[model samples]
Target: MRRRPATPLLLSATLVTLAATLALGSTPGAAAPGTQSAGTQSVGAQSSGARLSSTPAGAGTDPDEALAAARTALGLGDGAQSRGPGQPVGEGNEATMALRDLRVALPQLGAEQRREGEALLARPTDGGDDPVGQGYDSRSKKLCSGNVCVHYVTKGADRPDSQKWVRKTLQVMNKVWDFETGTLGYRKPVSDRSLPQGKNGGNGKFDVYLKELSGQRLYGYCAPEYLVKGNKRLANGYCVLDDDFAKAEYGRKPLDTLRVTAAHEFFHAIQFNYDYREDRWLLESTATWVEERFADDVNDNRQYLPVGQVRVPDEPLDIFSTTFGRHYGNWAWWEFLTQKYGGGIVRSVWKQAGQFKGAGRDYSTKALTKVLAAKGGFSRNYARFAAVNNNPAAFYPEGASWPSAARIANLKLSKDATRKSQATTVDHMSAQNVDVTPAAELKDKAWTLRLTLDGPAAATKPMAAVLVQNKKGAWDERLLEFNRKGRARLSVPFSARRVDAVTVSLVNTSTSFDCWEDQAYSCAGIADHDAAPFEVTAKVFKDK
Candidate 1:
């Protein structure tokens, strides 16, 4: 769950973890003040909202203030937060993070609020002081297998209507553990044995608790229990899942919802064994991608495609959206990498970001660019990916089911005519697609389309890709090089009979970020090279 609009928190560096399905909140394309080189048009229907109930009595609860409250709730303090009953989130994947943060921030909360936080952090089953919230159901049942112990209620609103669901959940989890760990080769979630026998499955088996989570509009979430001593990241953790994913509420068969959520939340547990403080974007996009690897049949995650990179190419790949944003929608990113380089590439990224002894200990983007260096460089591949989104139906194997990327500018070039566009600004790690159609007059075989782009300095990593589609719908792609001055030119067939359209995808591949300033993006900081401007000109002429 990614950070949904309102309703929760993100445990900061000293205690980072994840929730599986928090919807995002934000003015779709708004950049933080001073975080961008320029600004962008706010596109799409997504906007930010603060749950009135989740806001404390006296907190400044406007859109901006709520975002700050959320960030502060995330432990990224923008301003001092007044303590009351720990502010509870309305809905989101921030459930676990807020749950955990509430535990730590309890000292500053009022009596009633502190009690509320304590109750949520309570363990559901019998174990000394194990991870709980399920409450001790006298009829609580336990199912242990392979490397997990699942606790569920036998009766009550929290119980799965049948024991069959329990067995199925465990079976699915074992399958997930095998594929993600044994097959994919990720580190196992660290055991909680230090917590004492039976408490938090101290015997070494990871634990999963079942409860009615749909009430909160969440699928599932995981929480870190302890960090590697001296390191502020989790080495041990546990997860909680919806008892039954009722179709009426979740819009999926109970099993279908269970399959995707289990795969998703458990991966967060697996991540705990690595580094808990990895970038939210990477943490989420990759986790969402793995669900495909484990349960390709479900396809439940496709709902996110509309808000993802293919449809909203303007949003940077690494942005950790404040509300129901693209982290989940952006699964296509990892899908692109794994499909092209095989799943092992994703594992390699984790290894680089992992904080365990001998792990690379790098942050998310750094680990990503480094791993990509061996595969023809990061900017090259990223630009290619953005351009590919322009005509997703042709590029992605499942492209037919995906939406095409947005176009920044559209033009039809006639014989001996030229069109110069106003400067279009794009965000860091984002792209702008310009489509040019050859007019009827340019149908002659010898015609050529001349293209030029002016952008920020090469240090900003401005680059472009020319995608030429022929009448037969065959597509050809080529990368354009921008010199140190950030200007580049290319020419391609402009014959209407031979060419359908040419799309020039202008990309700002800059990865520069202001680290630890607590902005909701990679490095928890804003972009140092965002909203850079670019201008493209297209012309058509006939060769004698």
Candidate 2:
């Protein structure tokens, strides 16, 4: 989730009470803008719409006015509220309003205003203004240890307990950062003091804030500001937390929930240090995945597993959306990657993404594709990933051991095939598996199986597959890609000794990746897979 700058405000009486309990010191300075040394290298600027900028430009010179215009343009009322802490942000139609606003405002805006609006559209809203007019406590005390410095406003009656938890969580996060940096081959965080003349600032040790955030449900967020030095923009990272939420969620425990949230959000800081220009899915997915490593007991990331497996199983991993199914569900892809190639492979993918110097957006898929190509091309691995997802536990040892994976039911296959053409529907963002074993007489003899698939004729047609189990129990799979006519065919030849049972599956490919409302499908509706279901026909014949 993205965090906006909190307006300076007075602390509540509870903060004073907590401050007295902890004997806290004076508040630290507000987060400074990022700064880079003259000699430090800078990455190239990415085009708009390609990457999610950490320090997104405000709606306009007057943020309130711009936001009002945006709201009016999108036809949304002002009553919409940001998400609560630990909740999925920007899911469903919430993002549609922002996207549509940008589309409407872009043409009317002047060159400068257009650029500003575009920047705002590129990332999730930073909890607009502080909803609690109390403003953040500028005098919040600072506690520093290891690589982290936590700034917090004293609140509740658990100051000592909260402080201890914060320090421990930061320590855990540091350990994770060190491990990931070593494995991924990325640069470690460093301090810098050179800043541009404008509002942009400097970078230094990681900063954490404990305050009352604007969103009721917003757990916390990492805000990375930009610093310019001779046409180069660098990133400085900081985190904001809802002290109330932390106290409420974890209470007096070792702050388990807070620990998980810190791990997830801190990784976003680490990602900014590498390349904030990377895709949002990659940043969030990897961050979510890291939480499992640091705090496996939390199991918060598992909340999205069903989102990926059931809600949108047919959606391609590379597609982009602000929905929970797209962002959180992305952990599944990383989980599969970790299972297949080890955690280091994920690091390698990030390493490539971090060092990207090419023009335009270097998509996460492209980075992953480059890294995977060394072992095998992305297409081959992707197909394997899709197959493994069906029975995640059966294919991966780690998966088999985890109850989360074991409990998930793989798509079922049809019991028997009919002589005449028969059709079945696979929901959008979903998959269907059908088992097709020939009659006993037909199995031992040489025979041919013909399969036909008909679906929407989009640029990327839906994918179909035929998997056969050989005598040795190894699975042989063939992918089916439809033509412009939304039709695809696959012919499988079976011999008595080598082949046993065959399985047919279909994946719905309809999505909002490149298309918006102008297209026939709405971005939000695509998640439901509301379009026409594809038709599949299968027949078997004795070979000559």
Candidate 3:
């Protein structure tokens, strides 16, 4: 579940700032959900009035003129715009705020404050006999059954309705938990007998709080407790929800929102039993992804697809920022895993991640790669996953996959004289497309295009490929291999007299590095970094 930003409470105000910004008719930076943006468009779909004939209908024409017209028709200008500093771009709304809370606030809290926060998470402030301080009326009831116990505040006409909705949602949550645990083969956290047990006793029952939260856009979140020493195990985590926000957001069918949120937030509780401090991207992405399995009709996670696909498609999945799009967009990675391998693969990743006592952000990726290598390494699977993302609807062919390829806005690149090349950045499990034309001096002559990639040096480097169309309209792909310095230079030889346009794309193949010499032993070392953007340079010159 995503966290809400800390701000002054405004109960009387309409908290539709995020909803309004996400509405269909919003402006460029604030476009509606699933709408295409400038840089993250679909490769299969061409813009209106852009004529990209598959058949070299006019092959052998002057390459310079043809490329220029193609750029103009596609609405690509001189393309001198900077991709900006390596900051996580966000929609500046509740989701972004939630990311900020997790990425910034949680880490910045002092030792005492962090302990207090964790304590608050383990034992939430129950609204009892103090409405103002607790943020809800003192009247409350605990509904316990199966593996869940819902503590809801009963007040006015909303209490009865809230209780009924929560009861029903718990049934769904339990069913999902049972199925996931059975299929994934994960052990439910052993109940902590020393802690104060609820009505159900120390049976490992998770807690849920339904109350009127302070912030209007608070929604819901999961607060997981870490594993401790002695006879105590990891405390069963709790979930807090803003009932009023759920009602306002869902209108006549507010329970639908509550039901999905319950499934999503409760998964976070389950994840805590594994590794509470796992990578934020993996935590949120898997939590968001599980919502679909329990409640497909309530696509609350869909609101974030375009945020990642259209806004920053090049940003990789392992990016360590609070950008709402990048983190939420990570759901696609899990979806791909479930489809290609099976849901068990996801469980294996979590199981492996939980084994590490103080594993950092790279733990999730390392675990994932380790689990996936048996089928094939992360590099191989990542290449296929990246391709599927470009046009998910076409690749998935399933009814429930996150519709990313249908929505991502295509990236446009133009020749840059200042940089002495056309350049752009690509993220992990993602790709970027650049449109290139030969210089005027080399028109009608044979020339060589040198493509260079500069980025982190991993055991398995990212893949770069050049795609060009032949006279028969077929796209021939040329894969670029890297040298020892982690730089890949591909010399694309072409006759300016024949070829008209060329598209070069850089793809992130692996996100984490493994230091283990053998599978039987623990890793000697691990080098994990966020999905940092890498530069791709395209330089054109006369063939020697």
Judged by lDDT, which candidate is best? Answer: 1
Ranking by TM-score: 1, 2, 3
Model 3 over residues 460-511: C-alpha lDDT tens digits?
Answer: 4676556664444445566655555667777665455555545555566655
* Better candidate by TM-score, 1 or 2: 1
Instruction: In angstroms, give how far residue 198 of model 2 lies from its true place.
Output: 15
Best by TM-score: 1
What local lDDT does model 2 show for residue 505? Answer: 63
lDDT of each: 0.68, 0.49, 0.48
lDDT of 2 by residue, 226-308 (tens): 32222112344456554534444433233666677777776776665556535555676788788876777767666676666
Instruction: List TM-score per model, in order.
Output: 0.80, 0.62, 0.60
After superposition of all CA atoms, the RMSD between model 1 and the true structure is: 12.9
- Candidate 2 residue 477 Cα shift, in angstroms, is 5.1
- Model 2 weakest lDDT span, ten residues long: 8-17
Candidate 3 C-alpha error for residue 200, in Å: 7.6
| Tens-digit lDDT track of model 1 for 1-544 | 1111222322222222233442322222221221110111010011122311211211211233333343443233454232223232222445444443342343355554434434444455542233223354455668999877788877776888778888888988888888888899887776553333434443456788888666555677776544343333444567888887777667768888888888888898787667655667777888889898888888877878788898899888887664666888899988888878999999999998876557777778888999999999899999999988887787667888888898867788775555546468989988989889978767679998888889999988888999999989889999987899989998887888899999889999888877766566766667888889899888777767
